[model samples]
Target: MTATRVILIRHGRTTWNASARFQGQTDVPLDDVGVGQAQRTADALYQELVGTDVRILSSDLSRAAQTARALATKLHVEVGLDERLREISAGEWEGLTRDEIVKGWGDDYDAWRRGDVELRLGGNGETRNEAAERCASAIVEAEKAMDSGTLVCVGHGGALRGAIFSLLGTPAWPWHAMEGLRNAHWAELQYTGQGWRLSRYNVN
Candidate 1:
C-alpha cells in the first residue's frame, strides 16, 4: 500500500516575529510582508502539488489560519482549523521580546531555551513536552482521518518543529540541537501502517 503523506508548513513571519518577541498563543495577524511571504509559499506549493489532491489544515490562531487560507486559495481547497495545532502557550511571556524576557525573568529564559521544562515561562505557560504531545496527537489523528492523498498543516515555528521531531522519532531532550525551521518552510512525512517516516525536513 502507498503511504499517506503530510506536508507541514510554518506560517509566515509576523510583526512580533520581526521584533523578536515571544508570540506564543497570541492572535497576531500577519503584516503586509508576512502576507507576501504567504503568497510566495502558496505559489511554491502550487507548482509542487500540481494535479495532486490535497487537504489543508491550520492552527486556529489567526497567523496560521491566514497562511493556510492563502495556500488554500492557491490550491482551490477548503482550510480546516484545528485548535490542537496552535502555538505553545507562552502565557505571561506572550508579547515580550528576548531582551525583555532576560530583564524580567533572567535565567528563566536561558533555562527554557536549554530545554528545561521545570522552568516555566511564568504562569499558565506550557512545557515543551506538552506542546510536543499536543502536536503529535493532532498529526496522528489527522493521518487517521485522511483516506489518501497529501495534507498540509500550517502552524507556528516551535509547534511545527515539535510536531516534525515527534513524527521523526526524535527524542524531546535534545530537541534544541535540531535546527530551527524557517518561516513558511515545509517538511514532509510519509505515514505507513506501522509509523511515520521523514521524507523531507526544513525545506523552504
Candidate 2:
C-alpha cells in the first residue's frame, strides 16, 4: 500500500504572538511579518510539493486560514478548513501574556509548564489529551479525502503539537520534549498501514 504523507505547518505569527500573548481560539489574523512568512513558506512549499498531488487543509481561524490560503494559491488548490485543527482553547487565559498568567495562576502555570496536561491554563481550558484526540482525529479524517498523496495541514501550535503526539503512536506524557512548532515552520510525517513515522520535524 502507498504511504500517506502529512505536512503539518503551524500558522504564521499573529500580533498576539509577537506580543507573547496566548491567542487560544481568538481568531486573530496574521501580522505583516506573518504575511511575509506565509508567502515565503508558500514559495518554498510550491517548489517542493507542487510537483506532487498536494492537498491543503487549515484551521478556520484567520491566522491559520490565511497561511493555508497562501499555500493553496501556490498549488492552485482550494483550502479545506477544519475547526478541529484550531488551537487549544485557553479560556480566561486566551488574551493574557505569560507574565500575567504567571502572576494570576502561578502554581497552575508552573504545573502546566512542568508537563501537567490536566492543569488547565485558565482552570477551564481544553486538556492536552482532549486537544490531541481532536486534532489527531481531524488529521486522520483529512487523510481519508485522498488515497495516496501529500496533505498539508496549517494549524495552531498547541493543537498541532497534540496531533504530533497522537499520530506518532505515543502517550501524551513527556510532551515537553516535543518542542512547539515555530511560526511558518512544519513537521513532516508518513503514514503507512503499519504506523506513522515522523521524518522531518520543525523544519522551516
Candidate 3:
C-alpha cells in the first residue's frame, strides 16, 4: 500500500496557557519557557528529519506559526499557514483563567468540561463538531498533496486533538478522553490510499 506520513505538532505554550487561561482564538505570544520548548523541538526534528523532504504547515495564529517557523528553519523549508488549522474559538472565555471562567460562567464551564458541544461559552464559539470538521478537511487536503514524504502541521492543542480524533473516526464530543497534548508534542500518522492511520499520539 502507498503510505504518506504526517507529523502533527502542538504549538509551544503561550503566556495565557501558562496562566491556565482559555486561550482559544486569543493571539498570545509564547513565554520564555515556551520558546525554549520550541527550540528543543526544532532540534529534535532537525536530527530526525535530516535529508527528508517534508512539507511544513501551521495554523494562521502567531503562536502556532512561531513554533512552525522554528522547525521550518531547522529543516530549511518554508512554512505554510492554513486557517482551517486554527484553534477552536473560545468566545468570551478567551483570556479568562480557569478560576475566573468558573466564577463568571460556571454552568457553561461545567458543560464544556463535560464535553457538551452545544454549550456555548458566553454567546458564540466554534462547537467541537465545527472544529473537528475544519481540522479534518485540512488533513484531507494535506494528505492529497503529500505523495511519499512527510507533512508536518503545527497547531493548537484542542484543534490538534480534534484533528487526530476526527481522523480516527471518533466522536468530537468526549474530547477530554483524548488526553491533553503538551506544548511541542507530536502525533505521527501514516496515510494509505484509503485513509490515515495513527501510529502514535502525543509524543514529546
Candidate 4:
C-alpha cells in the first residue's frame, strides 16, 4: 500500500540561496541560519508526528541531507538518501546570479524562467519535464515502499515544485502560477487511494 501522507520539504537556506545564485546539484552546506531553521523545523515536526511512523528521505546534496538529518535525529529515525531527489541541474549556470544568466542567455533564460517546460536549464541542463518525472518517480516509489504512515522528502525548491505538479498530473509550464517554497517550509499531500491530493502548502 502507498504511504497515507507525504511531506515535501525544501531544504534550509544556504549562502547561495541568500545571494540568489543557482545551486543546481552543487554540494553547498547549510549556512548558520539554515542550521537554525532546520532545528526549529525538526522540533515542530517532532511534535506533530510523535506517534506516527515517519520515514525521511533526502536529496544527496549537502543542504538537503543536513535538513533531513535534523528531523530524522529528532524522530530517532535513520534518513535514506536518494540522488533522484536532487535539485534540477543548473549545468553551466550553477553559481550564477539571475542577472548573469539573463545577460548571458537573454530571451532563452527569460523563457525558461517563465516556465517553458521544454527548455533545458543552463543551456545543457534537464528540462522541467525531465526533472519532474524523476522527482515524482522518487516520491511515488517511496510511497509504494511504505505500507502506511508519512514519508518526508527533503529536496530543492524547483525539483520539489515539479514533483508536486507531476504527481497531480498538472502541466509544468507557466510554473509561475505557484510561488517557490520558502526555505525550511513544506507541502503536504494525502493519498486518496486513487490519487494524491494537496492538503497543505508552504507550511513551516
Query: What is the C-alpha lDDT profile of model 2 across 101-177, one tens digit per residue?
Result: 99999998888788776666587889877887899998988887787879999999988888888888885559788
Model 4 residue 13 lDDT score: 88
Model 3 misplaced stretches (Cα beyond 4 Å) = 1-3
Report the lDDT tens digits of candidate 1 across residue range 1-204. Answer: 442889888888899989998999989988888898888989988898868878888999998999999989977899998988998899899999888888888888888878774555556798776787798788788777877888888898888777777777774557577777788888888987777888888886
Instruction: Tell me the whole-model lDDT of each prediction, alpha carbons only.
Output: 0.83, 0.88, 0.83, 0.91
Q: Model 4: how far is 115 from its true place, Å?
A: 1.0
**TM value for model 2:** 0.96
Among all candidates shown, the one with the greatest TM-score: 4
Per-residue lDDT of 1-204 in model 3, one digit per residue for the tens? 232888999999888888898888888878888888888999988888989878898899998999999999888899999999999998988888888888988888888888886665655888877887798788778767765678899898887887787887776547678787899889998877566688888787
Give per-residue lDDT, candidate 3, residue 140.
Answer: 74
- Candidates 2 and 3: which is better by TM-score? 2
Model 4, span 66-115: residue lDDT tens = 99999998889999999999999878899999999999988879888778
RMSD of each: 1.7, 1.2, 1.6, 1.0
Candidate 4 positional error at 4, Å: 0.9
> Which 10 consecutive residues of model 1 have the lowest summed lDDT?
115-124
For model 4, state the Cα shift of residue 83 in Å.
0.3
> Clashes in model 2: which pairs?
none
